[model samples]
Target: MSGQPTKFLVPLLLPISWLFAGLVAIRRALYQHGFYKQETLPVPVIVVGNVMVGGVGKTPITMALVNHLKAQGLRVGVLSRGYGRKTSSTLAVSPSSQSQNVGDEPLLIARSCQVPVFVGNSRVDAGRALLSLYPDVQVLVCDDGLQHWPLARDLELCVFDERGVGNGHLLPAGPLREAWPRKALRHATSGQEVPCLVLRTAGIAGPHEFAVQRHLADFAVQANGAKRSLSSWWDTPVQALAGIAKPEKFFAMLREQGLNVTHSQALPDHADLQNLHIDTAQGDVLCTEKDAVKLWAHHPQAWAVPLQTTLPTELLAAIDFHLAAAQHAKLSSPHGHQTA
Candidate 1:
């Protein structure tokens, strides 16, 4: 099973999907009605997530946002649930941290951006942990926690790939983690629209959504920090390995780059590679950046392709505008000054 809900089977699964959606609605109601606690962190929180189940280029966007903010001299930290990690304890991610212990994505973010990143089951816990350790951090970015209502966010950016809402049904039927327009509309009912931005990671952007350009980096980085042009492997047959939500997308991107992928291995998202066999000697092994963290330990020769993105200037402006608004609102609040 691809773990994807089949389109043809959506009608059959609609009943179950409705049941799941009802449960989700109830959960949201619980949070909204004050039955559950939603924590507003001292620092402004920006959430980047997707309504669909699979990856929608959130990680790259997060990195881009972090870099953008860092260029402005703003201290930024990242928080994640650290999916697929072995440890349950909340810990600050560092270059020395193991991917299996803190998750591949968080480890990559920490190393690539050289910023504070904390991983745990709860975004609130991760945010607190990051701030407790790094008091100078000015902003917090929560990765893939759109459904986590317990953590109040100043801004939410929901990303979508070319798939666009795929059949427009909820889990076990379609690709959606929640209903599309209905979920977005739920926020509008509160007046003055939702504090969310819809973005298209690939393909044409919708009338109201922002479009981001994502592509493979021209060069691949080796474990020794050596650079190799992706074109170098164009003539030779290589094995493309991706352990991501959409491995085929990576394979397609490699093809687009003119790489001759004779073999492609689509592993489960965040598969435990500690014991996985990788015979790089068979041929050139190419992988996504997320897989490089663990694969490098075992196969240093593997080529890890990094993704480069061009974010819309308007999006950046909006983000800055909102951050300023949030800061001012926080400062003028009667809740007392809370820093760090």
Candidate 2:
């Protein structure tokens, strides 16, 4: 009985998965043949996403990359589809913007990175809108848009967690949103091949992949912007709540930090905690920063532990090379105009 479901579902889903692959191939062909158009922006776009489904720490990686670019004295902007947001209209994300309106991840990015972020269903539209408002922005970092073929990107960072391309199968059977080891993409306007780099966000990096180290910050933040050191919770019972894909990972990390987590609640990814009731008597409520964006509104007492990520210097160098090449190409083009 235990293995019966797997035997039944795998056979049932395999054919549909094959059909999905066919559709994906057809769509790629359309874009490759110019039947479908990919829009290009003036500034270079770096898309950070994953072929595998579910959250694989893409937001943390995106924030880290944005900060790195800013440190290099380049004015950077971010574009996102604003997944799970209430509104579909294009809008800029501000520190004051509600997660319900701008999406939790984008709101967190705007607050954390302190960079311009715009959300829209269309990445190209959001990119243009961001540029229109922040004309001096030198580059755009897309939060998650690897499969969004309509927007041309100069560089791609495919992020993966411990589950690297699970089962190596497509949806309905496996975790992949698209086929892995895909062919290179081309710049929509310039028709030049775009560069892609694989980043293993957790665990050991596979062959030809960069490694990203992620850990929780020593302190947790309150709704009012107050910081509490993790050491302060040593004596108190902790009730950890994570509304993320891999909540167990968060819980394990808390334990690793010597936290006494008495009660751990794993909510669905992007869950609306507005109506949900949390028992404070269990202990001190702790959550991920992504969850805190929305969770803080109703539960002001919840402490948000931010995930700190470190990227390889080699990865940054590779990105810098691509950015320089993109800049040269933009400058040499007769249609290019100065924005920075």
Candidate 3:
């Protein structure tokens, strides 16, 4: 949904946004010095992040970038902070890794991207291990890390899902992780207040941006990677479950694709559906591709829709320029440092 200076709430939230901005500024300054510790990765790191909260389709973009690098014949590895994981140590994400262990996003990445994927509280540590294990790996892509300055980054790609800096606030009051204007003012690179790379689903990033709509596939992929047409389920009213951000979007997409959805189940961001059993025996059950990574372990018959995002040619061009620049900078400097 697009944000606007509504008739009611926008003015009221201004003070709180200012305070949040102040807090962000303070935390960043601490990191700049030694007050807060930040880590440096041994290899070049590419971070894809967002200023606004929620799914701006980061996973798809990450997967796209990873594949693009792989197509270019460059060895690539993925690193994430493992936001909702159970373990605290830096470890590689296993195909058998549970969402509770390696976190949902990383698990999804590992599944689609065959290259090594790791998650830890430290992206730097993850990147280091990934590099050590696969020395040929030239690029490290970090998921959801713009504020995480601890691990330095060579290239930063910012994603916005139609929510371009919501309310332009920091934290609680709005969706932004930091103040928008302050970022433009300060030439902060790693995290402070920065303009990494603005992404519209299918548009150029440098000037203004445009949205690229994400549409669900007409079918769901099975546990064995088999496909089932959504139209096949259109005759019966069934359960449509989603555990990712914006579950309603999933439901809407299902309806748009002609699924006769009746029960729409929305769970927490990384919900463990292994425990919940639905009466799907009565009808067809559906879920999102990200959720299927976890859900299909229990219900192999679960149908999950894959979402594909189209990035504009212009942004792809911009990315190529930045990647080249980063590689050049790295090759040019004998001693280098970067964060995720």
Per TM-score, the best of the predicted structures is: 2
- The TM-scores of all predictions, comma-separated, are 0.92, 0.96, 0.86
Candidate 1 lDDT for residue 188: 16
**Clash counts for all predictions:** 0, 0, 8
| Per-residue lDDT over 1-340 for candidate 3, one digit per residue giving the tens place of the 0 to 100 score | 3334463766687787788778878887776666766655555678888777766678888988898888888788998887777789988887888888888889989988898998878777788888777777778898888877676666677777645565665655567777664343122233333235667763344366644556777778888988877788878787888987778888988888877787878887778777977886657778887888888878898887888766666767777776777666665665543333
Residues 3-120, candidate 2, lDDT per residue (tens digit)?
1124457778888889998899899879877999878788788999998878888999999999999999999999999988899999999988998899989999998899999999
The 10-residue segment of model 2 with minimum total lDDT is 1-10
What are the lDDT scores of the predictions, listed in order? 0.84, 0.88, 0.74
Residue pairs of candidate 1 with colliding backbone atoms: none
Could you tell me which 10 consecutive residues in candidate 3 have the lowest summed lDDT?
185-194
- Once fitted onto the true fold, the runs of candidate 1 whose alpha carbons sit more than 4 angstroms away are 1-4, 182-194, 335-340
lDDT of 1 by residue, 132-235 (tens): 88888889998889998888788888998888887777888777777777544222112223378888998789898999998899889989999999888877
Maximum-lDDT candidate: 2
